[model samples]
Target: MAGNKSFFETLVMEEGGNVTFGDGSKRNVVGKGTISVPELPSLSNALFVDGLKANLISISHLSDEGYSVLFSKDYCSILKPDGQTLLKGMRSSDNCYCLEASIVSNHVSMDEQIELWHERLGHMNFRDLRTLGKFNCVRGLPKLGKKANGICGPCQQGKQTKSMHKKGKYLTTKEPLELLHMDLMGPMQTESLGGKRYIFVCVDDFSRFTWTYFLREKSETFDKFKMLCNKIKNEMNSNIKSIKRIRSDHGREFENATFETFCNGLGISHEFSAPRTPQQNGVVERKNMVLQEMARVMLLNNNVPRNLWAKAINTACYIGNRVFLRPSTRNTSYELWKGKRPNVSYFHTFGSKCYILNDRDQLGKFDAKSDEGIFIGYALNSRAYRVFNLKTLSVMESSNVVFDDTRLKSNDHEEEVIFSDVSPLEEVVVSPNVGTSNVNNDDTQPIDRVPLLDSKEPAPWVRKLHDKEDIIGEVNESVKTRRQLANLISYTCYTSQIEPKNVEEALNDEFLVLAIQEELNQFERNEVWTLVPRPKTTNVIGTKWIFRNKSDEDGNIVRNKARLVAQRVLSN
Candidate 1:
């Protein structure tokens, strides 16, 4: 045996040459040589042999060489050789080969297999697809053959409706009092200071300037309009032109003869909106909103009392005129009207606790230097400021004032001590240790030892009553008989129960009836008894008189009370 074998051979080789049998399972060969082997077809070629059995079931080859004979199977064979069957199974169509002579007779290629893979995988562009063989997971995926555009569902849902009024159509006049819009608002539950329950507001259509006046009754609308018309006319020095059109709701106040006549007299055209239509006078109506909002904010910010909201509202309007910009103009109403920048240096904090100099009081060594007050508002007609004095219980005007801006909170003032000019000795003193002292005692009596007179006993006459008896009798005779008799009898019998005949008579009896009369005059001067008659439909109670006597320490009568009482009536 040779050490090397031919390319087409099934020779077994070892380190040395040795001959191996056809069945080499039990033999070992060490040499290589060219062996007699049948030629096999190339993988690229097909083969056809003459005189071969037809309907061959399979073909096989052995070894790594170009060819080696192996068992073949016929269609009707009982069993095929295991080695031959295995070799035939391993020979795939893609890997098979045949010689050039066989290729010239018959040929085949793997074009079908290559096409099958392309069909199953789909021809996706390698660059488009990720390197890992999957679609790229990006934020925005491009549509096939289209440019990428990100989707935003939220943006679509959040789209808003178009504005009603576009740019450039809003009111844009620059001068104050040139164009005015007027509207009346409310039959409010609360009546303002001055007992006003309704508000009539006028807004300058150009500058967005606002002026509000309170009315106790809506009938005052014409008066307010007239006042506004005169003010604007005098201040602007312009005639009541077409710009002086007065816009208002179809209220009785706006429709009444007084309003129409006033408008006609001033040559001002009246523009009345339809009934229940507020938007027709939209300018002033909208201004009312602006004013009310500002008023509310000011009241809340300064912690001002709600009852003083009228002042707060007025102050809000003043500040709004100075600060708020016109919708169409960069300048404010104050700047437009005054033709100069407004000075805000005089603007003090509203509702701040302040001390107003009491100009009404003549300064005394013991008098307070200033009166406690709350800064309410600025005076519109004057340069002074308005303050609500807690001590005086009145609204007062003062230009001279000191304010504590940090103290905007209310109900924090110290309680005031009210003093009277009367001496402390004048006050009635009740002492438990000492028995009630007599109001009347002889001046010559010893201070400690004299016995005080009983209150029930009548003291000695301080003056001669007999001297006046003749004059009293003459005056008593001039009156009607029944009245004179009633007076004389009532006086004599009820002297202890009521007041004496007169102050002089009471004084003659050592009584201070003059002092009591002086106090009574004070109550009358204060109008404590000016009662207006209630309406018939009103469920008013009937009043009655109750008499009482005021007494001193020793129980001596000092004054008398004639009070009225009422009896409740059933409500409807």
Candidate 2:
């Protein structure tokens, strides 16, 4: 009995003496099963019989025998119908049976339990399930399986090693201008019409209102900044308690001695962002971007020249202050500063073709009526408009102008003409002797007049003596000695005509000689000479003199041009 009980314990089965068979018949089953038993049913066969007896099924080994047998409740009842029958069967010669009674129970299969476990919990991998199973508390619980979907490649590629971000604490101020952001933007490639290539941007921390100034050079920053500050102070009528702090990048223009001295003298604090870190001065940097973008779009759309970008940016800032709403307040900076709505009716299209009526002109019948100009931008510090004249290639200013936004650009059309015509007048000419005659007729002889000569001699001889005497006197004055007189007489005898000889002699005269020499020297100083040596066999052309007097606009003599001519000789 002890051995049989041990077998029942190992197999997890209940033991009974007799059991009722199927068909309501009973059978006496036997005493305890023997130990070291042979020819017993296999685990599969035992499970088959147990399953037939009860809806709840399990499999186990009854003994070491390979043969399988089936037993049901009818068999157990037939073996032991009553207590006396069971006792009789236990004493029987062939009573070697141990009966097991069928019991009703509910259970689940291993596969169904696994599916149910996965449904209750989420999907998990085999490795994860094995790890969870190692916990003795959760051992024997069903495991979950994972879906085959994998990791994202793009996400892994995009992930980079990054340092932890340090968030800076916000600095608070009590007043509008307490803290300000200042930056200088460029030495732009194109120069503005006013010759400005750089711009200064300043922003108020509290209201986020921005002010910008176009500058020809960075050196103008201090002067323009002082002007801005003075204007603000005057307009607001509020003494700046303190500048408090000024933030900027470490540009040399902003960090120079001049700027430092100015700030120190004013007792204003200055702060510099870390090297190469623009985000530290993000407010002004963002303002620069906004202004630049607005200017770029305006220029591109209007086909305005790139040089006008600075003016466009200034205008952009002006319009932005009036139209752009504050991020926190939902009100324009203009409204906040001026306490009124901005009037946009005064705005005009930039770079549009315009015609300006010349109101200043008191026009004659033949004068041009109007001037054509291209609108460049609005004038600063005034209500007038700025325009560019293609004819003059200069900018002009006017307030009364007619604009045609849809005007077509014409290749033949000229720019505005500045008319400068005056009416012609007649002049009165007087001979040199007329003044003397007039004074004589009034019976008042002037002290400078010479006595009149008498004409009593005959016409021919008298003219001859007068000409001869004049010639003799001129010769006497010109000749310094007898030798020069002899040379002059010899030259006059050799030439064919006395007129030509006399003219040549006059050109060779001292005053004419000096004037020609001076002109040649002047030309040499002006670098108008080119020297070239003549070839031995070639005929060199002779040079000659040409005279011209250069004059000023008022007809006054300024310079004389004595040109030397060279004529090439043609070989026969």
Winner by lDDT: 2
Candidate 2, position 75, lDDT: 38
Q: Residue-wise lDDT of candidate 1 within 1-572, one digit each (tens)?
A: 22222221233333432333345622333433333211122221112222222212223322332343443232211122332321222232445332223321221222222222111112112222121112212212211211112211211222223554333447645445456788777876644434456778888777676778877678888788777767666766764343556677777888888777776876767777888888778778767765665555545444333444566567667766655555555665666655665444455555655677766878788666677666676654555666666554456766777765552122222233221111111221211121111111101100000000011212222221235655544644543344443344323322334454434444332113323433444567567666787788676655533445666564545455444345445322
Mind giving the per-residue lDDT tens digits that candidate 2 earns over 96-145?
33333221010113233333332212112223332332221132342222
Off by over 4 Å in 1: 1-169, 172-178, 238-243, 408-572
TM-score of candidate 1 to 2 decimals: 0.42
lDDT of each: 0.46, 0.48
Top of the candidates by TM-score: 1
